[model samples]
Target: MSTEVAQNTLSSLLEAVQPPNGGRNIHDPATGELVARAPEHGTEELDAAVAAARAAQAAWAARSHGERSEFLNRAADAIEASAEALAELLSREQGKPLNGPNARFEVGACASWLRATAALDLQPEVLVDDATSHAELHYRPLGVIGAIGPWNWPMMISVWQLAPSLRMGNTVVMKPSEYTPLSVLALAAVINTELPDGVLTVVSGGREVGERLAAHPGIDKVMFTGSTATGKAIIRSSADTVKRLTLELGGNDAGIVLEDADPRAIAEDLFWGAFINTGQTCAALKRLYVPESIYDEVCDALVEVARLMPMGNGLDENNVLGPLQNKAQFDIVARLVDEARAAGARVLIGGNPVDDQPGYFYPTTLVADIANDNSLVVEEQFGPALPIIRYSTLDDAIAMANGLDVGLGASVWSSDPAQARQVAARIQAGSVWINKHGAIDPRVPFGGTKQSGYGLEFGVDGLKALGAPQVIS
Candidate 1:
């Protein structure tokens, strides 16, 4: 489609579009009460959105990198100005504590990413030259990027994809998870005001919308974050177009505590890593392998920490532990807990759902004596459930940690700096933390390996993912 035609198509699409079919009625998973109704987008809407994006892509790509960056910076400013309202909406929709440091941290990261992308030099430029010839290379935008973001960290992940693509001069058509579509829409509102009409658009719905978006002929690339199963399906569907893809899929990340580590420190990190967001994080430390020398000590300390975590509505200042985002997540947590108990594992701390709660709420649970083969240890429970596995040898622990199909993120804890560094190097995950877990910076690239999917999502590497290298001689 011609650039003018595409622009008109996109304008018409946005003007006539209504929020997805599932109009507001979204509930606060924490309180089981109506939080807001989410707008749903169906296949037809998704098609129109993609058409609009494709139409705008060429014109967007024609702009100078500096021009695109300016737009990104403005969008960042808009997001920061609306941080409070966005945080509240996020908490209500996704069940994270609205007032928690994590919520604020997300807002800061969003703005930081936008500003960072703006400052980056992503245009084609010159390289070393010989006497006979001159060599030059330029970064070119990938047209019509299709970003399918997850519910857990909705706005942040969307920005992770959107910022780099937009800065690199690609128009984006995003499909936010139906579970947390409002926050994404709020973000889109900010972008729409700060950017060209078709620069960024959000289409919200269930599987059909995602499927349509992934397979849309106009989309040149697809970036998805969700379960490994869904990632595989997206890959399969994109085969026809051979679209460039970046998939940040499921992860059953492990935290290894060496015998030389301090049990107290390891326990603290483990608590926050595993239980934060009620363990809805994909990179959260789901399986922990503690050296036999510190196993009991670590377990005891973890139990104590888990007990102190306050569970209630996410909007409440005192509530550290919030409800699962939906009933499906609640059921998954409950099933994992039950399965662990039946398989001879002991609950070292909180287990089972909290009574007298309307929403989907699961307790911060620590399960001990969980075998590697057990469901809790092997599968991606994706809940507030942590299973502690004991290891007598460092080699055994490392082997066990890397045994899974997932290679997303891992953490190694040791008092000895050398030991921690060495162990971190050996882990198979894409990002490794030494004595820390779930720590992310916009300046650092993040993603996974193996079934966790491929490609980086932040930093210079992430921005490069949205562009192609063109050589001129």
Candidate 2:
């Protein structure tokens, strides 16, 4: 669609929409002021959206795979067509670098996921047979799926839930975090036109709305991506209905630099892995355990490289680090740094928030001499803060790396491939990159263990999360 036509369509779609309880203000992180207002959907609107989804479920499920595929393709096309506007809005609201590869990749990946899911045929079918009787397995949609997505990758994660569920014939009622709702809302406006009116609904509200949706008896499955504490509450809320769930919670992911690893090369990877998106990513490397042999060298390299990267508004292409999305994040990052310094950890680089910026902006911080028990070492900072803990032996390093309760992702750096792979295998994370960090593919299943929450988000395992296997004789 042309830009003018798309803008007109979006404006019309949003006309009657006033912000969930009445209207809510959206802030531009760079200015820390209200830039837009989103209409809040009240109980009545929430009920209607859910009912509409439930009402459309059967017909959507009954559509031939080919028919469903076409709709998904259309949605993908619409998303790609609106990528520029969506990316700008996303960067402004979510506080991520707009020109960086991450933002563009996120937009493109949304389209790719839609197309990929469209091609998948997740349907009921016979699986086994016997002499006297025949057995069959069937895959069926789970009525209405309630997805509570995080602000970090709002549009991408929204599509992650919507694509698979819709492909498997389930209707979705998605709730994006209030901090970054604009991107997903814009996305909804684009794709909603291509599908049945109620097949995909975006509910804009805060914790109350999310709590209502999670505990609501009508929702069949609840897929949430956020903090571990919230995930626990969601799990408890859904217990009564035994709602199927896929929770991708927080991670205190670790990066281990082996004695043989090149300090310069590994330091660059570590900086981007931990500092990208201001270190807000769940799978971002937050803790580093390095061999004492190269501890000083690695720390020095990180400091030198980090100083060269600019920090400013995400819209500025030169800015490698952006502000924290909101006040809560800003506070958390500040407290973590302060506490770490008090605990005797040496601040090797940036450690304080930039005072001149309107938004919550923290400097890229690296602290050495961190103890495992310190808050910065144990907790998921979710900011541009890196804590380095030194170890003398490989065994000690592995033990320290696996000490955290989170097991979402980790990275092991080494020049020896065999040694690195061995170390990678021992780490308790779902994904371990030998020489890289935060490397992900749609074909690979991504998730966590322990407190990081359960169930996979992508790959073939992701398909299983959307539907159920049935056996017939």
* Candidate 1 C-alpha lDDT tens digits along 358-444: 888788888998888899899899988899998889999999999999999999988898978988989999999988898887778
Stretches of model 1 off by over 4 angstroms after superposition = 1-24, 123-128
Reference-based lDDT, each prediction: 0.83, 0.84
* Candidate 2 local Cα displacement, residue 247, angstroms: 0.6
Error of 1 at 44 (Å): 2.0
Candidate 2's displacement at residue 162, Å, is 0.9
Q: In model 2, which runs have C-alpha deviations exceeding 4 angstroms?
A: 1-22, 121-134
